[model samples]
Target chain A: MSKIAVIGLGSMGYGMAQSCLRAGHDTWGVDINADAMARFAAEGGRAGALPADLDIAMIVVLNAAQTEAVLFGETGIVADLPKGAVVIACATVPPEFALKMQERCAKAGVLYLDAPISGGSVKAANGQLSIMASGSAQAFAAARPALDATAETVFELGDSAGAGSAMKAVNQLLAGVHIATMAEALTFGMTQGVTPDKFVEVISKCAGSSWMLENRAPHIVDGDYTPRSSVNIWPKDLGIVLDIAKSAQFSAPITAVALQQFVAAAGMGFGGEDDAAVAKVYARNAGLTLPGEDA
Target chain B: MSKIAVIGLGSMGYGMAQSCLRAGHDTWGVDINADAMARFAAEGGRAGALPADLDIAMIVVLNAAQTEAVLFGETGIVADLPKGAVVIACATVPPEFALKMQERCAKAGVLYLDAPISGGSVKAANGQLSIMASGSAQAFAAARPALDATAETVFELGDSAGAGSAMKAVNQLLAGVHIATMAEALTFGMTQGVTPDKFVEVISKCAGSSWMLENRAPHIVDGDYTPRSSVNIWPKDLGIVLDIAKSAQFSAPITAVALQQFVAAAGMGFGGEDDAAVAKVYARNAGLTLPGEDA
Candidate 1:
């Protein structure tokens, strides 16, 4: 069995660490949150220092900065990691940052897989995430055990880094925009006397529907803002997308416009609410109340 | 067989007329374009004026202006229609305008079903279009034969004139925004080294995919913009959406932004190309050549 260390212990990371434990690996769950690490320990996950013989280390932090801090920061794990081990970075980061990380890991005699994950927290817990991965043959080989335990679909995008992250940014661009647009359309329908429920019912069956629409519009219908994926996520993810696009001289007006909606949602103190709460921005603007909101 | 008159034999209308013929209706196909009318005649569609005993006169026109002109204009058909005949108005019009048309048709002793259709020309020709119909019991009854022949799914929105058009506007809001967003995302992928083919292959399977992306992105990959649905359609449809939103005092910034992209596309002389050609706007903006364009 592989000796796996999952750093972060957040929604995605905790679930992934559990998947590794379920697969009979010696799994360690590390996080700044002491309660999370202790809870993992209660569930048969190893706590404390990662083993010197760690076979795979999956970085599931928030973004590039955290990923860099954990891998190359003051108390970095790369220097302690065994040669030939793999670092499966599962954050949504810039392709250039991923390339830089991969190069830094290579110098430490470690393999780095530029793997950005999809499917939400529920899918992560069930070991059904779709991973877009890229790295060397050695990186793929070393990361195989955790991957088998955690992912239902692994898209091996290229033999080197960057391509996987590139695909992830493209996907984030589509996903973030769709959620915001779904909210925009739903609220717009309300002003036309189309109720939230009717909007979900008809649009889901129509050609306008997207995967995100089918998944999230129901939340608006129910007036739930419980953050399966929080509103704050878009500002971070889409910000990364817009950053990359700007660096590439790409004109993503829709993405730029969509980012502003998420930012407005955040400004309105809905950063931690479900992303569907972006509709509330439209609702507030149009002076219309959503399903559960008071008129 | 029902005596059916399908006016406006454009791509969508001619297809609906063909569907009526396929279903054994005694269908009369009419159009200002003599070429389109003659082509329908070549396909066994009946030629000549609509009979006074017409059971269903489907106004498959361009907008509220044409619909108003056809139903109440000089030499309008409502004056010649039999009392019990149904006018199935199949255009994406404002809900208020639909209410006005229903009132006029009622005064003329004709039943009116405010029906707006979805599904592209291919679905129209195959009799698989989705129709959102709202009218009284008698109107529904009178329009039943034509609805059965022309639509696969009839969403009975309400027993009124405006509801069907309201739902159509809602559907259009989502549909038009989705098509433009697909173009935006696909071309954004290109600027980041994601090829058009790879963008389609990966994103379609990822969370970013919408119905428009799955159906239209391949057109970009193959470098074919043969107008399965033209770019010009968006300016018309989304303009209707924005118009309705404006009347409702609704703020639709994303939609307003998306409309600009299509408008820019039209301004760039791609008005006649497929709606997927909106990617060309993004392409030109970023100084990147699309798959089928010369670099």
Candidate 2:
């Protein structure tokens, strides 16, 4: 069993930490939230400070800034990490940022793997997430135990850092836009006479259906905006997409409009609700009532 | 066997006519294109004018105007159609227009089944199309032979004309946005080194995928613009969606943007190409060369 530290014990991170611990790794879970750390300890995660000879540091933080803070900021673990230890970065960040982190880690004789994850919290806890990963062979070897623990499918994208993050951005672009479009069409159907249940029943079998639509539309049908994935995710994820598109001079008009809808959803204070709650913006705009709403 | 007339022998119409003939119906195929009609005749379709005692007049025309023109224009078929014969309207039109046509057809003692078809030309030819239908019980009974011959799945939406058309518009809204978004994400991926081939390989297995993406991305990977479903269909279909949304006071911003991308593709002179050619818009904007293009 490898020695591993999984920083940021949020939903995904906590589940990943659990997967590592379940796989018989000596795993430490770190988070600013003490309760999260305590809960992980209660679930058989290693207690106390991270060991110096850690084999893998899996950072499942939110964004680039937080990822950097955890790796290289004051009280950062990169300097504390033993040489040859792999830092498996799992956050969705720009490709350039991943490359930069890889370069800085390499200068300190540390291996870095750009590994952005797919599938959600449940998948993470089940050790069935898909990981899009790229780095040196040594990085891959050092990170293998944790990767084996947490991921069901590991797409070896390239022999470098940027490719995994690039693919993740591409995925986030499609995923975020799909969620918003599902909301747009479902609510638009409501403006006609198609009920939310009927929309789910019929469209899921039709060509219009997406993975996100099939996964999230039932939440709207049940009127449960319990935030499996929140509306706040789009503005951040699509922001990365548009930023990347701008640098490449690519025109992503559909993604642009999809981002605006999510922004509107956030502005309407549904940011913390389920991403399907984006339908509420359309429902409100058209003066229609969603399922489970006050009529 | 029922006496049937299948009008508008285009790709979808001609295939539908073949399906009717295959089902042992005494079917007549009519089209402005003589070669199409001649081809249908060679395939066992009956020749000459539609019979006066026809049990079904299935108008598989392009849009609402053509549907209206075929039914009530100069030399209109409704005047020639026998009483109680069903008119299976298979084009995408506004729900309001479907209701209006139902009213007009009812005055002539004729039945109208608002049956907007899905599945493309291949399924049309194979008699495996999905038909979203709504009409009176008598209308459905009259149209049953043709529907049975042509549709693999028939969604009986409601007891009237508007519901089928409304559901179709919703499907079109999502389908159209999905096609454009696939192009958007695919080319956007290209800008970041995610090749079209790798894109289809990976995203099809991920949550980012849609039915349209799985169906259309291959055309991009092969760089084939063969018109399985041409780019021209979107402007007309999404135009109907935005028009209906406007009437409903529904703000469909994502659909509006998707419409613009299709418009741009048409403006770029890809109207005759497959719908996947929408990727060319993003490819051109980003200075990327798609497969099989002169780089």
Candidate 3:
């Protein structure tokens, strides 16, 4: 029922675009890759130049800079959007950047919802993602259909742009660190005669478990480094955290250390692999072979 | 009913002693502090020197050194314990130390259960702690009555001493880092207009949460740093982690960074406060005042 444009056809964005189409929206898929656009069209997604009468432009780009370029760059969608159309920014950007985007969108007669998402690619595909959303009432009203289509849970954080992003940053800080810690713990257990399967079995039931641990540990157990969420994500996401921390003068030493591990994983050429591959970093350092990995 | 002695009537040990009593055991409370012992006695804990005929001696002492001294020092209890009496070592010591204790206890005709506990003081009092246990079948058999009384979940990881401590170390690696990361995220949220209360309310629902975050974030929101688990615990626990990491030649950068934050908190004179007060390091570094602290 709504005219929606979803830019950035990455794993998350592609799924979200499908969700909008699945909800029977007048959806438009935009991506740098023509293959993604063609694939979306093949999957019954509407294809055309985004209609000037667009009700929502959901930007799911990589970072703050890309989001800015998408909105204010040459041929920016904000210029194409009609008055009162909403822009749901779904990047894990800093709160300040979100506030700035909200202000810029307002100047263009657009409502901006700082709606960063979680629950990863699978949930994104299932239309069961969690959206940490904050915006003005008008922005929420404008963006409701896409939200209803894509999110099973939408945390309505506050009536401001940055609050949603702030909460997302908090979540990323924990999520990123937890993934690395899971790897560290799992491999450390390997050094002590606790097998990968047993590490998964025991720790998941114990107080040591996290959402990330539960989600990612099995990847290591199966020796499957296929990217459910790649090791490359942490550097970008934790980079956002460090940027926010630096700006706020907040010292996030744990987050800083976690960033280093992901960097190490990336450095060790596991960047494109599943984030759980971080266990390999620990295992390699300690001379322990994880389940399914070579000696 | 088995005859049981719970040494070291600290917050955790005292509650454990009460749990043993509640389970219908003839529980003896032992502590260097006469007041703790008297308090336990007033609560119907049996008063006497530990009996030589004790069926179980649960040494819920402080650290590796204390646990060692309690079992093998000149005035040690292992020599005093009857043959086949189980000594449940419920402190977070190294796995190597645990194996050493098991060997020493074995020489004295005793069984040793490497039973490090979780669920904190509240669960300790309720006789519902989770114990990560590994030892011989005979050791488990000898410790059954006390184990049944005190633990709701007992992970029988291996039929020897080291695996339980290894798992505990893995757990401590996650838990200690999680506490600091919670502090980091909570304070980071404050910089972006997310109140401590709202941070708790929102993030708890998001994927960014951990077991420690749910457990410890409330302490910060209430601005109560009452040492439910003090800052001093991390340096010791994560020190154990790094020691184990070093022995295995495993590089734990995140654990190293988290340990430093707790150490800084100790230096800031908040060491005696709850581990949640690690937020103080972030707060002071960023010039942000937390909920109850004087601005």
On a 0 to 100 scale, what is the lDDT of residue B40 in model 1? 93
The 0-to-1 C-alpha lDDT of every candidate, in the order given, reads 0.92, 0.94, 0.90
Per-residue lDDT over B4-85 for candidate 2, one digit per residue giving the tens place of the 0 to 100 score: 8999988899889989998999999999999988888888898698878999999999999999999999988898888999
TM-score of chain B of each: 0.98, 0.99, 0.98
Off-target runs (Cα >4 Å) in candidate 2 are none
Model 2 scores a TM of 0.99
For every model in order, what is the iRMS? 0.9, 0.7, 1.0
Best by DockQ: 2
- List, residue by residue over B1-295, the lDDT tens digit for candidate 1: 8999999998899999999999999999999999998989899998887876889999999899999999989979999999989999999999999999999999989999999999999999999999999999999999998899989999999999988999998888778888888887788777767888888888889899998889998998999999878999889999999999998899899999999999999999999999989988888888988886888
Q: Which residue runs does candidate 3 get wrong by more than 4 Å? A: none
lDDT of 3 by residue, B207-230 (tens): 778889989999999989887889
Evaluate every candidate with DockQ and list the scores: 0.85, 0.90, 0.79
Query: Docking quality tier of candidate 2?
Result: high
TM-score, cand. 3 vs. native:
0.98
In model 1, the Cα lDDT at residue A28 comes to 94
Clashing pairs in 3: B227-B274
lDDT of 3 by residue, A66-107 (tens): 999999999788887899999999999999899999999899
Assess the local accuracy of residue A251 in candidate 3 as a C-alpha lDDT between 0 and 100.
76
Q: Whose lDDT is higher: candidate 1's or candidate 2's? A: 2
